[model samples]
Target: MLTWIALTALLLFSLATYMAGRRRAVAVTAGKPAQLHSLPGYYGSYAALWAGVPAALLILLFAMFGGRLEAGLLRVDPPAAVQELTAPQQDVFYDDARAIARGGTPSETIYDGALKTALEDKAAKSQQISSLIQYGSIGLGAILALAGVFIAYPRISPQFRARNKVEGWVAGLFVVCSVTAILTTAGIIASLVWESWRFFQAVPVHEFLLGTEWNPQIAMRADQFAGAGAFGAVPLFVGTFLIMLIAMMVAAPIGLFSAIYLSEYASPWTRSVVKPLLEILAGVPTVVYGFFAALTVGPLFRSFFNWIGAQLAGGSFDGLAQYLMQVQNQMALVAGAVMGIMLIPFVSSLSDDIINAVPQSLRDGSLAMGATRSETVKKVVLPAALPGIMAALLLAVSRAVGETMIVTMAAGLQARMTLNPLDTVTTVTVQIVTLLTGDQEFDSPKTLSAFGLGLTLFAVTLMLNIVALRIVRKYREQYD
Candidate 1:
């Protein structure tokens, strides 16, 4: 509801601004430029931008920080009566108080005595305080808005220098919007860095980086040994590479061949018909691909192997026997094949654009020298576009590695370090998703593991992008 209100307010404010500026322009134009003190439209726009932009920013700020602000304000020291409880117990007490305020009771043991009585008292006080703060803020906002209107109205005069002021304000807004995006990216990186630092405190950095085992299971009690908390993330890395390789094997050749055929071989009419159809492949939701992998592709591969076995064994073989005798159902082949299908359009479309961007002069030069079309494409055009193609393939590999749904649904969740493509395995993203997707405590090693996985994934993707950018730069320089 607040989102709708904000949207409505922004639209109304913008429209009013446009109309006001238009009216002001007419008034200024009615007289000579020298006779006019200032442009009329400028005054109207000044009022509109001032009214809309600040209010929108306030709404955004409130939505982001309101709960935290309220929590901060109400974080009073629990009456001395509750001080005897341990830190965890105090947390429990505070949670209970908040729940009680909302007409709910907590299931945790409420230490009977002053602690319980104080909790009930504090709950009422916190609720009243929160209500007062909310009402006061709304009143303040309304008063400020009225003041802004009063200040703006008197300046909406013929002599007012509203145009210059408003233009300057608009330019400032543009800069702020750009800065906001940069700040958001920095904020995400900072948060990941902090969390990964905490994880490293619990698990040694070397163990995480160079250890070979990846068993993440830990005992619930801190006093007990953390069984299988082996920090060796090598198996996860191996699985990530293996799965990515399988997917790339499927996607790269098919996508590249499709791109080459579309760019160099297709007639104009065929290109027109086929390009949109190929692009449509990208629009298919990844979850759909996940289901297709698990329900359709996986079973189909298993069936194909069974059939192959039956043919080889005079039709006397069972499914499992056939699979064992002829083929592996969970081999990297199935997952890679499906992943390749998903990537075909991504590679083909990117490759096609780069190929098309190759100057016609080069192609014409090669053809004029009595070179065949294939020879021209291979020797001149493909060579020129190879760097871009490699960049695209690298990007596809990154996507495949980070992909969660396809692997989670089809690729078995086991964290096996085997190089065999036929063996079921998992990737970092899959482990991260499973680790964090439940009623898990935030401070637990299990939950914290997700952040470690995320940090690693981020680093890997970042490195790949850097390499691709460098390669692209080198290629661009060569051609230039």
Candidate 2:
């Protein structure tokens, strides 16, 4: 409800801002030397941005960190048992506490906790104090806005330069929004890094990095070799690569070809019809794809393999054929293929844009040199757009690597050191999801291992992006 309210306010604020700024711009330059300082639309945009951007940002910050701040102000010790609860369990604690305060459940531990009691008290106090802050903030903001409007309201005054002022405000707002997003990303990375460091302290960095097997099972007794537990991230990473490879194999060709067909071959009418239809594929929830892969696709692949084995054995039962079939029902191939299909729009849309953005002059030049359409496209347009195309592919690969829902639902969660695309293999994303999903102790190795996996995945993607950028830069230099 709050979210809806905030969003609606943002939209209304934006519209009002545009109108006010546009009107002000027109009024400020009613006549004389600086006739029409800027496009009225730009002035309107400035007002809209100024009116909504800061408040929207404040709302977002409050949503993300307000609870943490409120929690901090309470100064009560977090329940040790509650601290051990899994991520989902921790959310339940918050929910139950809210419910308790609202007179829902008396039996809940959240209703009984010292921390909860303190928070409830603090929440009341904070609400009282916040009424003052909220009014002050909004009052101050409105005053500033009115002052801006009053200054810009005058008609053709010598000092009036509404356009410049409005643009400056717009530019400032843009910078602030960009900084907020960047800072949020940085904060996330910092948190992940800190947690990963803690995990590395518990498990040896060398063992985690260089060890060959990744059996995280803790030993119940002393002197058990298998119980020693291997943390070789190699297998998980290999599994990730295999899945990505399969996904790319399916997505790259399909997406790229689709892009070509849309950008070059299709009429504008056809493109209008096809583009949205393809993008609809992107909108399909990944969880749904997961089920499709797991239930429908997995079984079909298993059946096909069984039929092939039967056919290979001439419809006779053969012991040798059974030995040949080692892959599980949820083959990596099925998951990868589905994931690739999911990524088709991602790659194709990006590729299409880059291809279209390629200079017409290049194609015309190639054609003037007696090149055919395909030849011109291949030799001139593709080369010109290759950097962006590579960037798009790299982005798609990153998405494929980080994708979770499809893999969690479809891909087998088993982490094995195998290159077989037909075998059920786990991915880093699936492992992290499963590890963090349940009702377990946070301090347990099982939970913390998710952080390690996240860090590793982050590092891999970061490196891939860096390498992709470097490659794009190098390719760009060839043309320059």
Candidate 3:
């Protein structure tokens, strides 16, 4: 809070300096605009940047590293009893002391010896040291800010190109932002790959990819009876794709047809009202869609299939009713159907924008060649927009593959492969969530397997995106 107050004061001072610099620039002009090198506003901005930028950067650095610096400064040789405690025990002791010093009541067992006295003393010293560091850092920031103004004020003359300097700083800032994003992505992938390597060391990679079984429940002890767990991932891949296929079957035609009507055929009033209502599905939370799937769509499908099964009982397939009765509310079909409903807005909005981007000249040319409006739409406009539609569908597919809540709520987590959508199944995402929900150590394969699944999912999604981009490019060239 003190740092914030100091920074706010610095900002207000920078603004004042900016106004002073602008007035100085005007004074240097001396009733002649030609005497100035840059605009008054540009000079003002340059002065503000000089007055605040270095100090703001210093404050940011202090915020990030101040805790570590204080921790180092507060370190004192512990008593023999405290030194004998394990590392985690020491951490707990320090945590309690810090909390108590901050006015929190201690609930744990009292130390009751020299250890308690030592902790209280340490806490008091930490508080005193922390306050000194905070105030000192603010003073240092003020000094640096004043130094920056002294260095910058002299260069704010008529001959100095303030605009070029400001633009150079802006360019450097942009480069820093870009590099930060690139490095962040690299770090994420590297972490996933490293942890996945550890997982594969314990479980064979080939079995994980190919074998039929997927029992991730490992025996906690060798004598515990559950076999050395199987990690075969085929069932998960199959189920993921199966649900995704069902979703596309429902979403593709409906979303595409809606996009076409809205883009080409709908009246202005109808499009304005209907488009927002349709896009509202996109804004509806995924958890609500999950509930809709589990509570509403699941039962409707169960009832429909049960009736069909009853019909099949009197027919040649007399034993099918017993099988269909097993089809319950929680299955891949229910999840996929509801997921398709959730995906419609993504498809519609993207496809509508892409269709609108198709050149009016192409439609006009097709019509001039004696083509009907429907013929022009089918042949010229659609072909032109097909690449973008395919890209949208691929994005929707990626979304479906990554979805968890709807699948968890609507599809029971039975790791078995079945072509029948009525059968229970689980996806990679659902299993990853299940595996990593609790506090578990990375020493066990069960916890590390989540990272393995994440890497595999990332690789598969990357390949899918690459293939989609290739197909889009191939068609785009033909259209061009």
Candidate with best TM-score: 3
Every candidate's lDDT? 0.76, 0.73, 0.84
- Candidate 3, residue 34: Cα displacement in angstroms equals 4.1
Candidate 1 TM-score versus the reference: 0.79
TM-score versus the correct structure, for each prediction = 0.79, 0.66, 0.89
Runs of candidate 2 with Cα error greater than 4 angstroms are 1-175, 218-227, 314-320, 323-327, 469-480
> Residue 156 lDDT in model 2?
30
Candidate 1 lDDT over residue span 46-136, tens digit each: 7776666665565556656765675666567658877777887777777776677768867568466777678778788767765665555
Candidate 1 wrongly placed segments (more than 4 Å): 1-30, 33-39, 51-135, 153-161, 306-323, 326-328, 473-480
The root-mean-square deviation over C-alpha atoms between each candidate and the true structure, in angstroms, is 4.9, 8.0, 2.9
Tell me the lDDT of model 1 at 274: 93
Model 3 poorest ten-residue lDDT run: 218-227
The TM-score ranking, best first, is 3, 1, 2
Q: lDDT of candidate 2 vs native?
A: 0.73
Clashes of each: 8, 0, 0
